[model samples]
Target: MKQSVTVEAGGARMPETTTPHHFVAGIGAGPANLSLAALAGRHLPERVVLFDRQSGPSWHSGMLGADARLQNSWIKDLVSLVDPCNRLSFLNYLVTTGRIFAFLNAQFTAVPRVEYARYLAWAAGELGTVHYGVDVVEVDFTDRFVVRGRNGAVATADHLVLGLGTRPRVPECFRSGTGLIEGAVLAEHLDAHLNRSEAPPAGQVIVVGGGQTGAEAVQCLIRRGYRDIRWLGRRHWFAPLDDSPPANDFYRPTYQKFFYQLPDEVRRSYLAEQAYTSDGISLDTLQEIYRANYEAFLRDGRAPVMLLPGRDVVRAGSTGGGLGLWCERGSGGRERHTAGLVVIATGREPAPMPLSAALHELVETDNAGEPLIEQDYSVRWKHSTAHKLFLQNRGRFTHGLADPNLSLLSVRSAMIVNSLADREAYTIRDEQVYTMWA
Candidate 1:
């Protein structure tokens, strides 16, 4: 029996009847969102929808260098921290692929980035309920979040997980044009560029940052055919081996207790101070590059890796023909370098979500005009809450330094799930949220 439904009833105008779809929808299929989906696949009997802008599973595919390795240990993969017993752990992936023996044979502490991505893809495939090529455009929170993708199709979820990843940070100097200077994340493309191209007449390629990306880019390019690559950094690139800080001490359970207890300002300060230690190139990677360059030097001709230590890139612009990068030296001097290509290996920042027009009134912003996220990483509502809106990768300042870093991603997922499971009783622990006193 088909009933015609097009009519104006009450104050609502009904055009046509639409089929109902039930789902707890997730936005973004990056590692963080995928981690949540994987857990849901294992635990949730109810329908769950996962959405990604990309066509399918890819973790930093743009920079998935064949030779690039992970900074964190294999145990620190997507799922192990939260659900070590989960079958989707990287160890499990290796075992399932029958590469456990081979991987162990390689005697590597951290798995290669490509291998990890493959593991993620395998997990995504088996998850079986993921939606590919669907970019969730808007989310409106009523009772649940009504998530709309690029198409007019909408999915309603009791909870929404926003794992929309970071955007590459392009500085103001590069506003003129990206072609003027090359800025790349995920180090491998630069490697390929250096591999295929000969050193320009300018001789040097300036890599601007001392972090992992910067160091890895310089190292990879120098390893390839590039003759001269200048690694510029605000701080001196120390021999990581000589300063091998214990990782456990920083991320230890005891430290986390103290860390969480500290005031937010102190926590921010602490994170700022440890940025180099946490995100810098590992001692091993740095040492390998240093050794390779040293060997090249010993061979008497091909040491092309030059470290512009203790300097910050102040300004960069096009020179007469090439590119001019001006820097401030830590030793109280300013210097400029002319390079054929200047690669900014700086990292990324979280991008904004397009909230639905219906729910704009409910959103509460922080003092800094950022969305107020709960400790469990849900956006707070002012009135008439319909559904839960969870943000996965979006809360950095609110959730502490662990938000974007892969440090506690899995545990965060688990906590999010637990919070969703017991939504009625959940309490947000973060200080960013406040009660609206009407």
Candidate 2:
């Protein structure tokens, strides 16, 4: 027997005719929830569904550079880490699409970002459970959780999973008098700007930030024949990612379990101390930038990029036809630089959760107003024992650096599915780890 309920729809109270009640409704069909949907299909077929605002499958499409490679290995795909034999594995995609031999012969140290994006789209197509073009605005709870979009009740579910993901964090300097600067843009939007019929003048261009995105933006400008480009970083010197053996240990399930048992203060301190393990730029990317600059200098008798580290842009303003930047140097001196265009790659912060106010009050929160997630990735709430609110990518402080990184996406999804089923859905095994941190 099925229970019917009325909900607000199109400014009028009506009944939901299209979407049926689901066992679990995942918000944001990004890699996190896509991974969950893949695993859940094996055990809870036709029971789970995901809603995404985008019209179709895409992962960081705006920033997908032509030569950009994934920071993590290809093996750390949606299902391979947990169930290698799963039909949705990256290897399966390669073999099924007839690119396995070409991919193997290419001898890529790291797979291209575009290929991974396509692989995700392929997996999403096979699952057939994701609802596109549905923007979930408010998630509230009644007898069961109601997921509402602009039109009204989209679906109801016994449990909810938030893989909301992150958004670009624009700094205060870029937000003052006007909404957005005229000649400045985010790194993600650089491609569109570069593609315009009227190419930007070969003048001074500034890239602000020290991470991978910033390096990519600088490289993009150089490739586009922007000769006089300035790359600024707050760090003393640009650093490469620490993908060493011991650092890799921090991403394993064994380390995540140990990290969860520690006190809150200890976890915060550890994250701060080891931030570089995941945040640093790739060594290969840095080398590419250097090589490009060297080759350009040999041909033109002048370098394309000017690396300026230990300089933080404190304020920005327009200088009529150009942009003015005031930077604080490491030597306690202030410097000013002018550029025809500025690209901001400052980084990203967590996207704001879309829980309704009434429902948010029922969920327990930390002093910082973040949901108190347990070791199993379920948020502690009044109705948690019955209706769970599972979070992914938003558990960095609770779970370790691996929470946000791609290294542990499958493991995290498996933990959530097991918790939802109240049984071990997938057996997680981490054996012979050498590092012991207590």
Candidate 3:
């Protein structure tokens, strides 16, 4: 049975009415979803509800590593981008935990990823509008959407926000269990597992991909006293990110002006082209890894980092106890590496859970299968005109580059709230009927 309830909006208290009324529902509780909640808390009427599949607020549980440091500036945290003065800002979080002065004195450019995770959890705790562990199973649009959850919880919302974050994009070669290549998403527990394992012979590890996670994984294995490691990436080598304070202009609200004007096809192509830089590790991390490896090399001929540029994993099969990896190099050679284990730091792509077969049929799409959304991030379908669905994180292609990452989360939240406010105003102007019509 669906739990019926109402919440306070502005100075008015809404009652638990059974009639089809306007509703806002968020499907996932990641940073993107929580950012939406923070925005809504300040602006959304009390009727909105946020849904998360996890037991609590966890942005990226798989990638959360203790030794891992954020690749972005500290100001890019949840609340700070939107309202630096807000009590929920990271500065406030630090002050609450008595780390403000200490952090300031450290002279570090970024905070630890674990600490940032804690900040997300703290922010969620204060928001209080989110429903954790209540995984949204299906979203359908009639006059309103009947959102079904895992334990038979059905919620009717006029709008549904899908923050279904990226699914790890494991390459085709590593997927088959029969292959020697193992696709391991080195996040949370998996990181600990890799750390605890006895160092392989010669302490050699093969890491593919050059993103922030890949760099961190390399750092972790090296710090754990591993010496021989090869970082085989698609690019020439890890390139530095132009993260100068002014370069942040690429991620600011003003940047959206240029992003929005681009055609959808251009937007899609741009995201694919720039994924490496926008999501790649900062220059600082690159330097740290290089210095550590250089120190190891100077101490002995043993270098912790090896660069295999233009080499891509081609095929994988077990040679024996360990694993044999075959790769095609930029030159005319097929390089083979045998390691204790092969780790694919290959990043993630957005994967949306299938809604009910019927529900899926109700939503319309463009030339691609992506949802055709209005400017407010509402899915445009012939069947549901009254219902407004705010797609949280799934609109990267439609909403431009700012939709997916935490880069524009604060301003993105504000934008979404403005859209929701406009939606509410329209409903109010029409005197949106709260009861069934004849």
Clashing pairs in 3: 62-187, 159-388
Better model by TM-score: candidate 1 vs candidate 3: 3
Question: Candidates' TM-scores?
Answer: 0.83, 0.95, 0.84
For residue 51, what is the lDDT in candidate 2? 85
lDDT of 2: 0.88
Model 2 lDDT-worst window of ten: 1-10
* Candidate 2 stretches greater than 4 Å from native: 1-19, 176-179
Candidate 2: residue 364 lDDT (0-100): 95
Model 3 lDDT per residue over 307-402, tens place? 777878887666664667788887778988877656777777876754667766777977777778666666776554565555666766765656
| lDDT of candidates 1 onward, in order | 0.66, 0.88, 0.67
Model 3 ranges with Cα > 4 A deviation: 1-22, 177-189, 195-203, 245-247, 272-276, 423-438
lDDT of 1 by residue, 319-383 (tens): 77478877888889899888767777766778877787667667787777677777667778764
TM-score of 2: 0.95
Write one digit per residue (lDDT tens) for candidate 2, span 109-157.
Answer: 9999999999999998988777788778999998888898887887888
For each of the candidates, give the backbone clash count: 4, 0, 2
lDDT of 3: 0.67
Best-matching candidate per TM-score: 2
